[model samples]
Target: MSPTTRVLNASTKALYRLCLLLPLLANHEASAEPLVIELHIPDAPPLTFVNDPRGHGIVGDVAVAAMTRAGYTVKIHVLPWARAQKHVSEEHDHLITPLSRIPTREDRFTWIASIMPMERAFFSLERRVSSFAQAKETYRKIGVGLGSAQEDILRSEGFSDEQIYPLAIGDNPAQMLLMGRIDAWFNGVPESRYIWPKVSKRKLLMSSVGSNADLYLACSKQCSPEMVEHLRDAVEALRADGTVKRVHDLYLPQ
Candidate 1:
């Protein structure tokens, strides 16, 4: 070939190679920019909490592992349940987990994955009450955490607003029950069980009141669809590989 023709062909090849590399370089730069994810967790022990001196908990660990695997830089903030839910509802790209999937909240957020199954129950001081019907008829007051699914369930079960005693986050309802401040306590099985031993020696009369609810990791409605899909895939993979179960087991009472 002529020298001029050879030079032109070489230039064309180089230009094509550069064109191919440009998009890849751009993608690399985008990926290098960390995906900043915020998780709003409550102080629910053995499920999600900041320990006295450390920060790892069951749901927190699972979430961090899954998101890290999915290439996100995660930042978890421990806050009151009400505040957490508010942040997820109002803030863009915020996440909350170990949240019970209830009818009222179904449309508020994009549910990413089911993390655990939870049962809501009514508990009275040992031998104080037997059936839910009896408790309803006898007790004039019930203690439940404000802004919790348990509180909603109680309201649906015909408990009047006057009969409901709303406790703040981190307040021990079991203690309230023992103090006779409330006739019964309505809460999740695991959470109630975890707190009962610390507050009372009497065995609680437990009566299941709600159907099994699945806890989920959910994101704000304003979260990008791409981010939601990424998180969903990561959590699904963790469940499939037993990482979720493993993390739960790690925090179970020994």
Candidate 2:
């Protein structure tokens, strides 16, 4: 009925689920050799946020499953958006998933790619919105989710930081816009829901605001290219067998 009530409900369900997870993971030997992976997922939910030892949600589950299928043990680590990038860059023997692959990131790491599509999501008030170019010029400010790839893309596309605002993971960027804190918010698709209800209360609109991109599983520069190739094959098999789409359709928001 209320925003506080909704958040409270989600929080309680999370705590209840966590209490049941430790004994389950601790007691089991994984079906395949355990490979340590540094899954690079953000706090935005129904995507890669943790449900604990199970490491619940779509991207995380697909990675763990693919790793297991490839005969490697898996370990999931959650990082602040920035630290996750740093960890995958500097850490040895770790893998980061759901990372975007563009010319800029080319040759930076070994990659395991997916046919799956993802987007850099953004939103602004319906009544105030216009062509992206006009919005860029007209709005006094825009909110970018901190630690996101959107930063580089927007910068390369010529967005001035003077027009940019940054918000933490749980901050409601939509609310920020509705409250006149920013003009729009840019982030991943699943993240929009995080601030939707908040904006709805103010009768503001939220809509998709960026181009689509391919997502990948990236390993550190030190990881073997052959290993990366194997991971690529494993993911390809998952796609052929329909596991990738099944998971994609199942957990990810439409």
Candidate 3:
């Protein structure tokens, strides 16, 4: 072969290799960048507290730890319970924390792992009922979180619209109960107990277990499987290492 032709052939081969190498380099750069994940939570106490400096709340603290362990940057959004749920449901790769895993929500999102167990009950200042049936007949206006799993549970159990006073997730239920706006407050037991003391020094009576569920760290239906697996593994590790319980204890009274 002529020297010029040989030089051109070598140059052509070098350029072709460079073309193949460029994409790999680009992919490496992309992979090296930390993935940013959105974490949404309600202003529910013991689960999340909007702007609590002490790591947000129990589930919030655990979520941050898990996300950090999964090698991702988490951006937390404190939204109303209903709005947060709707947005997470519509968006891709978004996460909602402390979401109760119920039959109605089984297909709405991808359940990553259980963050905590949810045992719901009714709390009253003056009224007490032995069973749901009795409570339904006894209480005229029961307070519940707006668009929460508790509301869904009540509706499913035949609670009429007029009977349920849906309040935004917060300490308002305790205040409402004290003000005589709601005859009873139906919510997660931990949340109720946590708020009752903050709002009033008075004691409240709790009814029998109203609903049972597991609160989960869930992603949107269109979430990335790789991300899901990373978070799932991180959360499982935290649970196994006693980190979850440790975080939970921080919010509960000693």
Candidate 4:
């Protein structure tokens, strides 16, 4: 009836609406700020790089995209291959990318998604070995990434540690081969090809595939179930939507 009463009633209604929206606004703010996750990667090129301004690499790009899609703000750490693996293994809920999914590593990390196929081979400057056995016999010293699946595969195949020259990833294994420090370099086929041109002009003789595996976006055993599920679903969607293939083609164009 009175102007003051009408104004009071309108204010009360407005206050009620504001109160109702407070809880929703809080929830929205909480979701707007994404969960921060640490992502570790090795320096292997065309797969994951340490200092590249454009991006990490093929699989690295995929991992970042998946994590972003899963509502995570990724904090990337570029470490040595072995150190990255150890960091992820020891740190709770931390993630590592392009890790080979092997039997020995199956239980060490919680697998999120398979990023790409990992096909390993031996590359030599002067020789073309057909098989692992031939490589073991023909090469006096074989260069393998330290603490990499390639090293484990070599050891499992009966190649003694004395014959295996373990080098850190991104330490220029191709240079070691070119300098005659190692007779051959054994690593992922894509990585070897990607690095050979960067380090040398000579032709690299590649051997047949030494092993087959899939590189995965994996996390520590203590990773949360929700995180795993979200990342897994994001990766699957990326795969389905051709985002993963597009990222791969950036480095390994066919």
Residues 1-254 of candidate 4 have per-residue lDDT tens digits of 99999999999999999999999999999989988999998888899977788688999999999999988999998787788888789889999998998877888899999999989998898989999889888999999888899888888899988899998787567889989999999899988887888887899898888899999999998899999999999999999999999988988899
Model 2 regions lying over 4 Å from their true place? 1-33, 52-55, 126-131, 193-195, 198-209
**lDDT of candidate 1 at residue 2, scale 0 to 100:** 100
Clashes of each: 0, 5, 0, 0
Off by over 4 Å in 1: 1-27, 52-55, 126-132
Give the 10-residue window scoring lowest on summed lDDT in candidate 2. Answer: 29-38
For all predicted structures, in order, the TM-scores are 0.83, 0.74, 0.90, 0.88
Q: What digit string (tens of lDDT, one per residue) describes model 1 on residues 64-97?
A: 7778888889887877787778778888888888
lDDT of every predicted structure (CA atoms): 0.79, 0.68, 0.89, 0.90
Global CA lDDT computed for model 4: 0.90
Screening candidate 1 with a backbone cut-off below 3 angstroms (N, C-alpha, C), the clashing residue pairs are none
Screening candidate 3 with a backbone cut-off below 3 angstroms (N, C-alpha, C), the clashing residue pairs are: none
Question: What lDDT does model 1 reach?
Answer: 0.79
Clashing pairs in 4: none
lDDT of 2 by residue, 1-254 (tens): 99999999999999989889866776665533355655566665555666645355566677777788877777677778677877787766578866777666666666676645666655766544434566577666778766666666667667788877777654556667767778777666665654476447555454545667777777886786766777888888988899877877676446
